[model samples]
Target: MHRSSDTIGAIAAALAKAQGELLNPEKNVIATIRSPFPREESRTFRYASLASGLEIVRKSLGEHEIATVQTTAIDHATGQIQLTTLLAHASGEWISSDWPVCPITETANPHRMGAALTYARRYALFALVGIAGDDDLDAPDLLVEPSPTVQPPEDPHQNRPIPRKSNGSIHKPRQPKPVLSAEPSAVLRDQLVAEIKELNGADDLALWAHRRLPTKNTLTAEDARMVETAYQAAVGPLPGRLDDQVTPLLKTAQKRNKAHLRFVAEQPCLVCQRTPCDAHHVKFAEPRALGRKVSDEFTVPLCRDHHRQLHHHGNEIAWWGNVQIAPLEAAEKLWQETLAAPRPTFRSGVQHHPRPKADERGASSRDSG
Candidate 1:
């Protein structure tokens, strides 16, 4: 429960933070992020880009120093390229802006790299276009100035005193003018009146209105009428008084065995021994009269497919009762009955024992003679 609460709290906090960032434009700024593949040792190239006011640079460093190269800068507004030669300088090892890098021997601020790249790009452009007044170099075909910022006008209502015209003279006053409350529009008033009339005709609305207005306490006639009308609209005409007919059932099946029902769903099916199973009642008695109580004897587990079959054929109660019987005893009885039944028999032809051999007897007599 504590873990769940913590997770909810974290999610709520994140949503609130995101909403705050969106609503407050001054606090939000666009940023570009770049990082090198730390394990690779190839020659690194410097990259530069603009986003909001944030510029980003990324590069990898090897043992060899980078060489100076001539580069062309494109003018955004004029579609012209200015060429200039510039040296590449290493600014030491890079580190994460938001996290500390303990393993790196040298570390530089992440934000500084972006700033340096932006300045370098601007300087290269200016030099190529001969903006610094180099007489030897010819000016580029097209030159453009950097973009400018535009500021909005201040709001008159913000931190300003209200002006009032008195006796044909305008003057600022220390206190603000009293604000008069506006009346409801004619259309809204007409709509409310129509709803009130509709509600007055309904008995349920009258009861609800009475509850809202409270008969025991003092109430204006207009207020009572409004409440009565609202109640009538909310509840339609009924045979008995609103309170008498709206009584909750004493033994609602939905409430009595909620836990048992959940257990039935979670437990594996007895026949298939697989999840998840359906809970079946053992009797086809009136469902409403059974109430909400769940008992082991009354409930049986069946897989979804089997449960559907039982319901489809109106055999759910009968199947449940069969499962409730002692399954082992039934199986044992079935086995015993199978064994007791007579089976087909076969017999071999009869064999008789022979008397002493005549040859043996003759031999014995001759020996004696």
Candidate 2:
């Protein structure tokens, strides 16, 4: 260390000795960042904003005498924001540390760039000060816990088939394209039927698909194609597709309805009528499987805060039930109005509309591959 820095070091040591207990990172910082956008399908959450992280450090560090936190632009190209935490001692000496942090945003828009800077500053402070906070994006989705009554599968990977590598490319084995004949032969049909049976029963799933899609049951060629698609999608061909934004044919209908309901339901908090809302399905009509409330068409807008309130406090169950009753003319009117209004082109952080691609039968989807 420089001889000149010795004096500054001594001052910092003494200050830390006297006030170290006060800088509890846990007390100051929000450990778990509650995401504004939570993907139910993936069961993941987004990180907190830069402003939030910084405020914690600022508040915690202020207690140390004559302390100040400043963030300066360090690099424009790499989008690094340097944060400096400074403390000036009474002996005409000061101690400081500079933590340079990189931007997190992938895109380079001016607004987004600025936000990245703020995020960098916030993280830099956390790094330099040893603040503790859980990064929401770092964790994976929670898996379903095994039921005590049921015997767990011997191999966790038992049913998982070897993923296909493309033969077209060296990276993935090339899968033989299924013969696109008018319909498969009896043996092939039995095989496809067996595959579908292994999954969430073919009858219920097929029935669900028939109800959702414009297809006939059992006999129609279209129905057969859908069953095949559903089987292939579930088994091996489409790896990692179970977690896709667009559910495969057998799995897609309910999720599709939910997505459509959410997109069309956007407006304001139904209770307070404000933007930055959530689509809360009013289930007063009837409770369906997978916690679907009536149909997704019943989804109405509710601000995040109020939405939480409804879920947390169920004292108003009767009132909520009343909203679900048929002849919901008022709800229908609101739905029509939103549909009639111009569609919002942008929904910050969320890409792709609730509407699915045309080929996918209006099921919500994104670049799952």
Candidate 3:
């Protein structure tokens, strides 16, 4: 606090008188901030305009023989902007306070510096006097919000204020705002324009264009190209088209074994549990020569009814898909198990083969001593 050589008794008394008649400044200014970080939800901030706040306090102070002057200067020692508010009484007694000005931008931004100076003057005046606007007292520092119509400098390296805490205090430096280029790609622009012109007067062109364009106004070349790119991606051929091609047959050296087919036939139908089945080959499981049956190792047991149903379906893949069963997987499992089983051993001139009970179509092997 700075004061005149005389004690501040007269000014302090005048300030006390003015405080009783002072009205809380009206919050007349509205600011809408669209932040890009942490998702793009817009927030609305309401604060008193500097002019409105000054009018209210000055009117009250004048009635009580108190005059106030606000001035700005550079603190040479610290190289900081300082706002000094002086309240002088008619008796030569005065009191003043110096407040550090917070710059909106780090660089020497004339426009932002002007805004910062105005912001500092209002807060400092309110503090010197004993009054505040609604919610203004709660804010630890002034918040400099730009008007919507004003475009900021196109500096890519510009810094933005840090987001306020829940209590509205700024404890850290600001972050850099994301910059979007204004100009659109020239090649992309022409291509999009040509395509759009061809669709003129189409029945749904208006609606389609409205939905595609970012806004109703004439779209920039860049925006039009973005829409075209998005549309092509939406209607373009999907990835992994190779999966639709037929899988080539995987050749193996193993010869067909009738005994494996016989074992498969002994099992129940893959679709139904009725016994006395036929070893049905899943032709689609592997590619084969025309009119040649697949190896017995690929045969799965099916009852006479299901076997006929499968042939009627014609598309083996489609039939398996409808039945919600994988005969190819079952066939491979059964063949491997059968091949791994020990050959029948003869004891006392009698043939011995181990037989395990079948759980429906799934086949298992066992050995009997």
Against the true structure, whose TM-score is highest?
A: 3
lDDT of 1 by residue, 1-369 (tens): 011221234334433333333211121323333433223333322332223112111111112222234444443222123334432333321111111111111124446544544455544533322232112224422343657878879877788655657775668556643322223333333444454455433333433343433331233344434544444344443333213212212221322344445544554555555567776553322122212332232444566755665555443433434334332222223233333434435457545433335674343323211
Report backbone clashes per prediction: 5, 9, 1
For model 2, how does the per-residue alpha-carbon lDDT over 197-291 read when each residue is reduced to its tens digit? Answer: 65553234433443433322232465466565654454343343222222222222332254345554455444544567776755432322321
**What is the TM-score ranking, best to worst?**
3, 2, 1
Residue pairs in clash, model 2? 165-172, 165-173, 166-172, 166-173, 166-174, 167-173, 167-174, 269-274, 356-363
Best by lDDT: 3
Q: List the residue pairs that clash in candidate 1.
A: 199-229, 204-231, 205-231, 205-232, 209-227
**Worst-scoring 10-residue span by lDDT in model 1:** 96-105
Candidate lDDT (C-alpha), each: 0.36, 0.46, 0.64
The parts of candidate 2 lying over 4 Å away from their true place are: 1-60, 74-108, 133-369
lDDT against true structure, model 2: 0.46
Q: The CA-based lDDT of model 1 is what?
A: 0.36
Return the TM-score for each candidate structure.
0.17, 0.29, 0.35
